[model samples]
Target: MTELVALVPAHDEQDGIVATLAGLYRQSLRPDRIVVVADNCADLTAEIAERCGAEVFVTSGNRDKKAGALNQAVPAVLDTLPDDALLLVQDADTVLNPGFVRCAVDALDEDEGVGAVGGIFFGEEGGGLLGLLQRMEYERYALEIHRKGNEAVVLTGTGTVFRARVLREVRAARRAGRIGGGDGYYSLASLTEDDEITKAVKTLGHRTVSPDGCWLVTEVMPTLPKLWHQRMRWQRGALENLRDYGLTRVTLPYFGQQIMLGLGAVALGLFAVFTVIVLVTVGWQGFSLFWTAITLIFVLERTLTVRGAGRRAVLLALPLVPELLYDVFRQLVFARSLVDLVLRRQEHWVAT
Candidate 1:
């Protein structure tokens, strides 16, 4: 029976800290201790977390954003933890289902080689059009992770469980200047610390897993602009992580997949431009049957793949208009992210 300690990294999340703590308290296998790291908070986040029965640690002058705050907090928390304990890191804005911890722990226990386990996340219930679209996107994302089985490429920051010993090893490596120079297990060089940690765990000959049974619910960006910034950050961070780690046999396929996606987007853009030019030049008669067939096939595939979301998702995807538009938007974001990465543009963390 390994003890579990939970850490919630929050910044000005006063309104939602209570709910996040409540969810942990309601877990089927509750953690032995729960700590909230209130990083540079101007709001009542620390007060709210303490009122909700969480041990709160307030940080001052932590400029590295979430990773730096975690760096300051993790060492202190681990100093009081037992050898057999596990560490669960979750976002303050997210809530876990009652069985999430239990299932995730079970997955870790089943395999000694498994270093970490992450949950499948879905959008929180209720929202407008943007939220609905996010819900659909999350469903598809979760389905893909499930399909990948235990070889999950990234351990999401939304909700992840890590072995206590592995975390200590990562921290020791950081302190020794073997990996990135930091005081904690997380790295500050990349925008996506979770992904960097995942790579580190793998380099240590450990595997990362995502159990389908462990479901986490989180708030989605309520508008397109917000979503865009969030995704741009993610994409740019992924590029940075890969750049830092360089290409390995394990990461080569992941790199190739992203490259293919980008190439596909380029092809789509070219096709769109050609279609517009043809339409202006020779009316609709210039349209090729082969091009029309390709477009319809792509739409059909997207629609069919999105059917797992729900009846509402199926309905929303049926017309093919909204989903197509969203795909275009995503492709554009990916292109921009690539260009930024190539040009060495600086990306800062933007809180939603």
Candidate 2:
């Protein structure tokens, strides 16, 4: 049988870390080992991890944040495991399905070409409109990922499983001067290491996927501002990773997604401006018709995405869907992400 180890990178997550660890402990198919790297945290993260039966590694200096913590912990983990073990990288605040570890490892073992796989995450059982909006956004993203098929790169690091052997091979290949053809080669260097790893695996003729069966539950942002910040960070990281891989590489396939989304944003902005103009020039009836059409289109979109999520998500998100789609919340986040990345913003590790 193959071995499996779970790696969780955490910092200052005292409030929620205990619950996350407890969830891990309750998994039906327990991992052979669970390592929590508490990165320069001033809280009880290490203690909490230990109490939950996870081996704790407290890092003294965490300059590069999460990526750095992973780089530091990987070798230590490898030292204690067999060469063919599976390694999972997840956030400290994430809760997994009881069968998460078993299903993920089973999938990897069943297919030699399956390099990585991640599961779906639902927002905490119930909150109000804010929680529902968060759930809707995540559900939409997950559906798109599944619909895009295995040819696309859509793996999320939040709860991804990887074959340690494949990662070992990539490292070995890089060391032996087999890939990249030079000394400055990066076995892994993208801002999102998970993306880089999945891309590399694909480039090497392997595949990564997100299965529909496995599921995890995570808490959503309690407020709009927090949700905006979280998504902005996510989008910016994705774009930066995409750029690092060379914009030209993504231009052919991803160009459509980019253009369509950009155009959609512009079209919506125009609608907002035109609605005001028509109200000034014509009357309230014209503005009402325009908004009615917009509202209908949004309702249809949310309806389609909410089929399996439950009625609460549908209703809570229904009222906020218009604001979510037309509002500048995500746009502001995306723009801020760019500034943060460019300014090399000083980011401290915080629990998601």
Candidate 3:
């Protein structure tokens, strides 16, 4: 039997830690041990985790954030487990469905070349407009991952399972100066360590997959500003990770896709600004049939894409203008992220 252990890196997550632990306890395939790394928590995070029966390791003098905390905690417990043991890294605020672990384990067991498996994340319900929008976004994201099958370019941090030996190999490579070095298995330089590790795993000739049945629910940002900052870090972090690894034949298409999307967003923004200028100066005569057709096509595409979001999503889609506005907002966020990346601006992690 393959031994399984879970590592949760948390910082001031007192309110959700108990529920997270309970969710794991109720898994169809339970792990042998659950370790919670309480990094610089001012609340009852450590206390709650201990009360819930998790082995807690409180981090002191570890200022590298989630990556650093995981680095410190994972090796300590992982050293005791066998090479074939599975290591699961889950977010403090996430709740996995009972089948999640079972599905993830099956995925890893299915292929010797598969190093990691990430879960499809569905946003928790009820937060008003922002929440609904985020839920819709997650639906689309999950759908895409399912359609992509076993090939996952980016492994999400919400919940991911890894083969212990693969992680040990990654750690060895880091120590040998083949990859960037940090405190542990994960690197602290990138804003999104999960993305960085995904690239690393691929470089070692192992595939990272996400199975549709392995899904979890997580909290979504309740406001526009919060969502903006969260996405900004993600976008910039992706860029940094790619830059660090240097583009290869396998990564070229992925990089190209992102560049194309960013360029398209810039084009759309300029067109929108031009259309507004024309409307203000030349009245109704300035309206172009070409732009109208393109707008309708985009609205239809977005509406169809979000159809899985339920009745409320349908109602939200009924107003095509708002959906278009939201797309513009997303485009602007991506654009800003590119600018920040070019300027070499540093973005710190903030729990969302």
TM-score for each model = 0.93, 0.82, 0.93
Best by lDDT: 3
Off by over 4 Å in 2: 125-127, 149-153, 170-191, 247-252, 285-298, 317-327, 335-352
Arrange candidates by TM-score, highest first: which order?
A: 3, 1, 2
Question: Backbone clashes in each candidate structure, one number apiece?
Answer: 0, 0, 0
What are the per-residue Cα lDDT tens digits for candidate 1 across 1-352? 7888899999999988988999999999999889999999999999988888899988879999999999888888887777668999999999999999999899988898888898788898766767878888888888788787746667888899999888988888778876673657899888889878988888777888888878889998888888999898888888887887778865686699789878889898898999899889887885579988997787677677767667788788767788768888889888899998899887777887
Off by over 4 Å in 3: 181-183, 280-282, 285-297
Please give the CA lDDT of all the candidate structures: 0.85, 0.69, 0.86
lDDT of 2 by residue, 258-292 (tens): 45555666776788899799889987763467878
lDDT of 3 by residue, 1-352 (tens): 9999998999999999988999999999999999999999999999999999999998879988888888888889889989999999999999999999999999888888899998888989888987888888888888888777756767788899999999998998888877774636998888889888988888888998988888899999988888888887788888887788788855686699688878889788788899799879887785579988897787787788888789888778777766667777788878787788888776777766
